[model samples]
Target chain A: MEGLWALISDDLPALQIAVPLLAATLCVLIRRPTAAWAVAMVVAWSSFANAGVLLHRVLTTGTISYVEGGWPVPWGIELRIDLLNALVLLVVTGICAIVLLAAPRSIDAEIPRDKQYLFYAVYLLCMTGLAGMTVTGDAFNIFVFLEISSLSSYALVSQGRTPRALTAAIQYLVMGTIGGTFILLGIGMLYMVTGTLNIVDLANQLALVGPNRTVMVAAACIAMGVGIKLAVFPLHIWLPNAYTYAPAIVTAFIAATSTKVAYYVLVRFAFSIFRINQTFDGAHSSAIAMMLGIAAMFAGSLVAIYQDDVKRMLAYSSVAQIGYMILGLSFANEYGLTGGLVHLFNHAIMKCGLFLVLACVLLRMGSTRLSAFAGLGRRMPLTFAAFVLGGLSLVGVPLTVGFVSKWYLVLGALEAGLWPVAVLILLSSILALVYIWRVVEVGYFKAPPEGADAITEAPFSMLLPTWILIGSTLVFGVWTSLSVGVASAAARMLIGGGS
Target chain B: MIEWGLYNYWVVIFLMMTGLYVVIARGNLIKKIIGLNIFQVSVIMFYVSMGKVRGGTAPIEAAGFEVYSNPLPHVLMLTAIVVGVATSALALALVVRIKETYGTIEEDEIRRIEADEDAS
Candidate 1:
């Protein structure tokens, strides 16, 4: 057993990517929905376990570097996982695994059975891309993985029942392609100047080069490119429609993982690779990020308040949640960066749980409209209870993960001597309250339409996963050692690397 | 004095902007995709041009040849071209489905139809 464990541990990085990718191909070949789902489920759980092991290894031994094909680091592609990506890897894979546990039931309702196998296959491929992006230390390899994930998501989004899904997918495709191209161009420019595609090497070379116009341009291009993917306020137009019209499981999975991964990339580019202050003329970039994040917080929350569709409201809320993460990043201090990174994990758990609640509602009622949620609190007690708990977390009430993340963010803001930013963070939590309360009122206070009594709770299969994530909101909220502890370590590493 | 040797970059910028403009201005899905293609091609051209040396042949082993154009960018761009092609193919496929379902591939028309559906 020890020998077997040793063998698996040696190839963890390669296995993280290859398992899903190869399984995705197997899913396509299987061509049976149940079989494909089983394959995807097994792969998701294994990847989750693999991510857990990788994070453990990183925490114990520090960064793990794997050189592909036994080639040298500067020339061959490398997979590097420091604390930052190890934390992100856990979030991505953990969310994927939990969401997949609830997927089969939700997927059955939204997608035609004939195409369900294709759905699972594409889902695994998307997972492959996201995991690859997290693990790769090569500059060009990030682009490759970004495209893999983007293309698969486009395909997944278009699988929705409504025709609007197609439009959403196309818009996302165009914007996403533009974003990918910008990244490609930036990588090309960096290669032109530094002649290396290794991220660490590029960072070292960039520091030595010291503020060339080409490097500045490269940084700007990569920032904007990742900004598009990150959906940082102005670039978030494609998000709402895509989420609103997508299949429930797709919306949950992507909402939980994709933007978080994109934000990880943004963190990497800003802190790890370009060293934000040095690249952007000192503190100007932070001001820009702060402004955008502030705008996103208010604008996203205000927009969410008016959305009649519950899924659309949550999607807009995702925009605002992304703001909190970015706001954490803008502070660039250890506490602030920890807030951002911890929010990445906290938000993934809560938001995914909330979406899973929607999936349960959709499974039973055929809709996620506000009107459909009337008296759902009485009928689907477990699911709506999950929603309320998740909503409380979103509102940053004490004893919830949301509160944990927000506390750190506020602490970070105060530490940075930006008391106004702290006040604004509190104010935005009120906005979150207004939107979440809107749903609560609809779910609890409003009367069910006539003859709505037959509505039942979501299946155990679905509710188990929903509550697992919802339960973790409280679990991690009280036990900050796992989320906040790892996050601060990652934040310190980033700050140390940057300086 | 302007460096005439840097003419390739000028072409790249022009093509890139033109492609971006078309992608933004065109309402037709197919045209938008074509614009995206143009935009991608500009980047590809930029990378390919960067790899070229002043007096280099294709990267190959020969007794007399000393200088060879860098093959890395060319190889990288090969992967990029494949990605670009995949993107276009997927975009075109989505366009086909949109046309079939919405009965029009024009962005305005699709929006109008969706807005009508939402109202009812």
Candidate 2:
């Protein structure tokens, strides 16, 4: 049993990807949608368990490097686990497990009966892709896994019954392809200069080659590509529609995981692979990123204020929250980077909880329009309570994970002597408060429209997962042992420099 | 002489810009997809060019062929080609669905129709 545990521990990273992919294939073979969902749930929960084990291993043993097929690094594909990847792996699989738990009931409600199994299969493929992207050490392999996740998400987005979903999927495909192509072009340029595709190896070579035009161009291309995927301010045209038009559960899962992974990729490239600050162009890139981050914070929130649809509003809020994450990254110090990394976890929980609450409301109300939520506080008290709590978290209210993230972010800024940036961070939360308060006002104060009084609370399954995530925002908010400790360790590892 | 050696990059950049132009300028969905294909093909070309060695033969493990081309980029390009094909297929399928519902494949037309629907 000890030996078996050792073997599984050594191979956990590969299993994290293989299990979900194998389950995805098994789901295709299964006839019943319920059976397929069962297969997915078991795989997802097991993956979550495996990810927890990996995180524990990393926390204890430091970095674990797994090379495929026993081939050494620089020759074979590598999956390296450090504190950062381990933290993200736990969050990604954790969110996958929570969302899958809530999926069956919502999938039945939203997806066609005949196609439900296919949705589960594709959903697992997406999980496999996201996990693969997070763990891989090869630069080109990141592009491959990126396409896998993006293609699966495109399919999942288009699965909704609305014709608008088809359009949204098409738009997403175009934009995503452009992003992927730019990344590939950038990769090719970097390879041309360094003659290597392995990330750690490329970092070593880049250190010797120093900064040049080709390297800067490569960095620019990669940044823009990831920026589009991360939905940084002006390049965020593809996000709101995709979020609004995708099916409820699909929106929930993708909203929680996809852009978070993209942001992770951005951090990997800038800090680990390129070491952007070491180059001559480092200050330029950081400045531009900071500018865009500030803009996205304001613009995404301001746009979120006017959205009539609850899902769309939350989607815009996600954009704003992504800005806060980016702002932390741009600070380039341990405290700032810790805030960024911690916000990744906090925002995923905060946003995913809110979307899951929206799923609950959508299941009961049949519409997510602001008007449909009138007097929902009384009609569906538990679900609305989750929403209110999630909204408060998004506004950075104390005793929530959002407040913890913002506190560190403000500290990081003040440490950097950027007082105005700190002020802006606080101001944006006030903006967040305004947007969230709009829904609260309507939910609690307004009268239920005609025929709305009889609408019941969401089913227990949906509310359970929603409240679990909402509760964690409070738990991690106060404890700070796990989230903060891990985030600060990951930040130290990143800022300490070198891959 | 210097410009001549860098001609491949020039051609690659031109093709890339043209493809992006078509994608951004054209309203027709099919044309946009074709443009995307062109853009991706330019990337494929860029990568394949990276592996090229002057006077190098095919990257076979035989004895007298000393200056061999890099095989890694070729392998990566194969994966990239597969990704491009998958994206194009998905895009075309979505375009088919868009046409079925909106009665047109033009971007502006779809927006206009949606706007009018929203207005009414």
Candidate 3:
């Protein structure tokens, strides 16, 4: 038993990725949807446990690296875990478990009867892909896992009942393929120059090769590819429809985790693998990131204001939130990266909470239109209260996780002496307030339609998960040590200790 | 001779640009997927080309084989080709669904249908 425990602990990172994949296959074999969900639940919770154990190990010890097949570096794939990746793994798997707990009813409502098991199967695959992408230290391995996630995400999005879901899935496929191809091209270019694909080795070798035209082009291709995947600013055309059209659980899970993982890849590339400070190309790339980050913050918020569908509005808001994250990274400073990394955690909580509440509202009332939200505060008090709090967090009100992330972002902007960017960050939060308030006003102050007066609360299962996320927003808001401390460590490790 | 050697890159650039143009310019869903396929194929070709070291032969291990082609990019592109195939299949399935729902697979027609839905 002691030996078995040692094996599990030593192999936790690989198990965190592998267990979900194995469970995914098992889910496909299971014909009953409920049974599939049970398998996924066991798998998801075990992954969450693995992430916890891995985080504890990384925190207690140091960075952990596992090479596949006992092959040394440069000859085999390595799964490396540091503070940043461990935290991201925790967030991805933790939220995935919570979302899966809330999924059975939502899946029942949103998907056809026979296809429900397949949904769980695909969900596990998506989860495995996401966790795999987060843990792998190989550059090309990122692409493989990225496609694994992207392909499953396309199928997951298409499982929605609305026909528009199909279009949204296709749209994402086109954009995602282009993005993945660009990333592959970038990796290929890097391999051509450096003759290595392990990220750490690539970074060391790049120090010798220095910046050339091919390196510059490779950098551009990778940034563009990851930018699209993260849906940073101008490349976010596909996100809104995909989020708006996918099933509520799908939207919540993917929205909370996938883009965060993609952003992790972007940050990993820019700061760690490429070591942006060491090359001239890094400066140009950071400039573009800053420009697009600012653009996305303004454009996404402004477009969100006019959207009548709450789901669509929240989707746009996510784009703006992504902008904030990218803006944090653009600064290339410790505080800036901290802000970015913490926001990745905080935004996942708030948005997952917010979207889960939206799902509750959708489950109660058939639609998610702004008009359908009328008097929901009185009718569905628990769910709307969660929404209001989540919305407050989204607007970066004090004492919410959103505020902690934004405060660091503003401080970073100020420290960088970009006062205008600081002001714009504040201004975008106000824009967030306006859009969030639109729903709050319509929900709380307005009257329900005549026949809808008898609407009640969301089910206990859904409400439980929604509140768990909402409660975290408040808990982590007050105690900054968990999110902020980990984030600062991650930031220092990423920027202060890079190749 | 330098220009002759570098023309390979120029041809790659040309194919890539043409594929990207078709993807962006075309309105038909099927055409867009086809264009996307073209774009991906260009990338695959580029990867294959990058693996071809000038004096390298097939990477079979024998006593005298000193110059072997970089097998990594070729292996990477094989994975990429599978990804490309999966994406195209998913895209085509989505197109079929789009046709069923909107009665047309043209981008403009889908937009018109959605806009009409929005108006009412």
Candidate 4:
């Protein structure tokens, strides 16, 4: 009850998680679609409001930690609101607001009317799960919320009203389970060495057991687990089909937020939660980081160039973008870490905008095939414009957010004297241009096949969100202050600060 | 024949890896689920095994005991078991759906369908 009042007192972190969870259960009891949506809207708005306040609080006062049930961590569950978690909280909650507002229409169209209320309930549940995972400081709590999200995600994807969606959900389920198991195993490894589940305590205890081979193996296991969850390169086999067959709104949410959260976990582990002890006894860490990251970059981009379906191409591109984030991380420098952080937020926006545009096109064109988008530039100018803005960001065009990320990345590579890596980054951008231009050429130059009638542009519900992100992509491109400042501060909190 | 804190961990690690390899190598979908079950159980085993302290009984507080198997990891693992159950249920549901759609539970056949899907 006190935790409940703490939320009422504007503690922010509790409100961020509790609002959606309580609202989700209440929504289920209501059993009315409109009422469910109203509740979900309130919950999402509150979550977003709470996230913004939390970000400001973290920026002003450093990390704000609350011990749930009034028990301190290592003995009880805790929530830590730091710059990193707050940034993620804003992105997650912000997307939830848009997805929820946009959901009723798409959900009714794709899902049966009878099942619409369940859809909202599950989506909100998944939102609560994702938010809880980010806010919680306990390793085991991460797993709990991770499962909640994955479980609901499978149900959401399976509600695609196509048989293929079932298969996609199965593949995702198998891989997600494996990933979760690996993470749990790694957490177990840490607990065996340190005897604590609190992330802060685990980091402190890691120093005494720093030299053990088990610790190194634990790191590798954790990396691989997060890698799979993020669909990093080779582990990305389930991605294309899953995104392709899923409900478009489901694709938009998962593509935007899911892998990025896992990527945050990986960065949290390697950079903040465990980096302190490594510097004293220079562990051979950089080698593994380089090996996995560069491989993901090279392999993911190459695969993306060959996909014919628009959604598949975008899915492969997700892997390539994840590669860039991972590559920046492997640089293990201040600039590299900042670039990585910037790319995380940038990728979320650009990818969601890109996928939302595709969702709009899917609504009109009846397929996501590149051939169908012929002359879309003329027919649906706004959608195509949003697509182009997103594509330009994808290709790292100058004076865009993508360019800012690449500029910092190239600097980091040069700082490390990794000239070859700088070249690979350039090459990957070319590959991105190739795939993006495939659609551009089809839309602008190619003629629509005979009997294909002009279709209406996607509704304002869809177009507005795409444009908001497109405008932000341009705004952030010129206004590097926000992106660069937050990223550098976050990098310090990750790499230099002990916590 | 009793050993120290380190010995207890070795057996758990060995079982965990063995389960992990089975999940990696197996191709049948149901068998993969079983492999995953073993894998998740191994993780639970590892965590619960770690919670054991030397000369500790169950974690409930009795007046005279100096050692208590850490209560936190145990509570956490109980939650994890619930997570594992949810994962298995979702996995099984997906498998059922895949079987209904593709008419095959073997992963190779599913891959063939996916490849066919891309080609067409």
Candidate 2 per-residue C-alpha lDDT over A1-499 given as tens digits, one digit per residue, 9 for 90 to 100: 9988877767888998889988998998995898998998899999899988888988898888999889988988999988888888889999999998899889787788898889999999999999999999999989998999999999999987678889889888899899989999999899989988899999889989988889989988998898888888888889999999898988989988999999999999999988876656667777888898899999999999999998999999888999999999998888888999999999998889999998998889888999988999999999999999999999999999999999999998998889999999999999999999999999999999886667898999998999999999999889997888998998887777757
TM-score for all models, in order of appearance: 0.99, 0.98, 0.98, 0.94
lDDT of 3 by residue, A1-499 (tens): 8989976766777887788888888888977888998999999988898898888888999889998879999879999988999999999999999999899988788988788888988899999899999999999999999999999999998887688898899889989988998998899899889989998999888888988889888988999999889999889999999999999999999999999999999989888877885566556767888888899999999999999999999999999999999999998888899999999999999999999998998898988999999999899999999999999999999999999999999988987889999999999999999999999999899999998866889999999999999999999999999799999999988787462
Scored against the true structure, residue A175 in model 4 reaches a CA lDDT of: 84
Error of 4 at A371 (Å): 1.3
Total clashing residue pairs per candidate? 0, 0, 0, 0
Query: Candidate 4 DockQ category?
Result: medium
lDDT over C-alpha atoms for residue B45 of model 1: 96
Query: What is the alpha-carbon interface RMSD for each candidate?
Result: 0.5, 0.7, 0.9, 1.6
Better of 1 and 4 by TM-score: 1
Instruction: Report the candidate with higher lDDT, 2 versus 4.
Output: 2
Model 4 ranges off by over 4 Å: A1-7, A276-283, B1-14, B63-67, B113-120
Q: Write the per-residue lDDT of candidate 1 for residues B4-110, one digit (tens) a residue.
A: 88899999999999999999999999999999999999999999999999899999999999999999999999999999999999999999999899899999999
Model 4 Cα interface RMS deviation (Å): 1.6
- Residue B29 of candidate 1: its Cα lDDT? 93
Candidate DockQ values, in order, are: 0.91, 0.92, 0.82, 0.70
What global local distance difference test value does model 1 have? 0.93
Model 4 / residue A131 / CA error / Å: 1.4
- Show model 1 residue runs off by greater than 4 Å: A1-3, A278-280
Interface RMSD of 2: 0.7
Question: Which has the better DockQ: candidate 1, or candidate 3?
Answer: 1
Question: Under the 3 Å rule for N, CA and C atoms, how many clashes does model 4 have?
Answer: 0
Total clashing pairs in model 2? 0
